[model samples]
Target: MQPIILENVIKNYLLDKIQVPALKGIDLKIDAGEFTVIAGPSGSGKTTILNLIGCVDTASAGKVVVGGKETGTLSEKQLTDLRLHTIGFIFQSFNLIPVLNVIDNVEFPLLLQNTLSPKERRERVLKFVDRVGLTQYAHHRPSELSGGQRQRVAIARALVTRPQIVLADEPTANLDSVTGQNIIDLMKEINQTEKTTFLFSTHDHSIMNQARRVIRLHDGKIQANA
Candidate 1:
């Protein structure tokens, strides 16, 4: 089934009273459980696509439907609810709380959900922490972990929510080559085992090659979809 659909989508930003087009008449569909990459150079609209799919930004025209709901038609509260329950995000910077340890950071999303008891939350967090191979460093703060380990923690945090789609923007940009590949391997493994859809925006050639499907963007338009 298609979990994400963008039809003739357009996005524009105002810069110094000038309207800059980021995405122009783009059409795309992403099937569920696919490991996909949006590959492009800087200013190629990769992040803009991710932001639109993640429901964090609006399109100037056309439709963005996630998990069977049209994002533009939803109210603010409905949009927040959709984002909380259906989407997960990973960033290049490893956006983890410095004060919270690995496990706590993983459990943070569940706290916002408030659907699980403390004990249940702990169990879920521990499971993902182990899945991400961070069980040993569960008590360590983000500052104490290596760059790769910290990104692993971020992965666990993103997966702990059991989101249907995980949108990652330049997830490995900060890591060395070996570490970046390892991180990609981990994400690929999780995508296979958990059957979660992963859509990543990256300029990294290595990552683009690793993806099962690659969508190349250029100057706010799709140059290749393969």
Candidate 2:
């Protein structure tokens, strides 16, 4: 099954009691293990599409299927479970808990799911933490880490769950060019090695160049898929 599918999807936001269209008739599919980027200028619906596929938001019209399950059909609890179990999100802001140390942050998701023993969770968390090159900083809090290091912790946290699809929204936006490129390379390495399907929403040309496939969006519609 494909990792993501959006069929004639549309999303609207209520602004000042008026409906503002975010996505317009979006029909897209991302296969298993594909590293793809949705490139667009600001307000082009890139985030909207990502949210739909990530199950953070639903379509106002049409269907969104993630990891073979139609999001529209799932209950709120099921949707939460799907997001927790099937999707990983990397935000540009590096949404790590400032008070939590690196290892604790990475282990948070496992704790939430409560499916693994403490020993198993620690082992899994450490594996991903090392994969992201942050094992040395495992005991450090977010404030103690550099921008790039904090982002690395975020990446490890996202992967510790071993989700089928990882969604990154402008993941490199806040880093310097060199750090951003390094982060992209690190994610690419993980994508290749772990065969994790990655879908990124970014306007960064560097990320677009690194992506295996680029889907360009404009004015809330797909302009090109190449």
For each candidate, what TM-score against the reference? 0.98, 0.98
lDDT over C-alpha atoms for residue 103 of model 1: 90
Q: Indicate the worst ten consecutive residues by lDDT in candidate 1.
A: 201-210
lDDT tens digits, residue span 151-221, model 2: 99989988889999999999999999999998999989999998999999887897799899999999999
Score residue 118 of candidate 1 by CA lDDT. Answer: 92
Worst 10 residues of 2 by lDDT: 201-210
Per-residue CA lDDT of model 1 for 134-174, tens digit only, reads 88999999999999999999999889989999999999999
Compared with the true structure, the alpha-carbon lDDT of candidate 1 equals: 0.94
Candidate 2 residue 2 Cα shift, in angstroms, is 0.2
Residue-level lDDT for 150 in candidate 2:
91
The number of clashing residue pairs in each candidate reads 0, 0
Alpha-carbon deviation at 28 in model 1, angstroms: 0.5
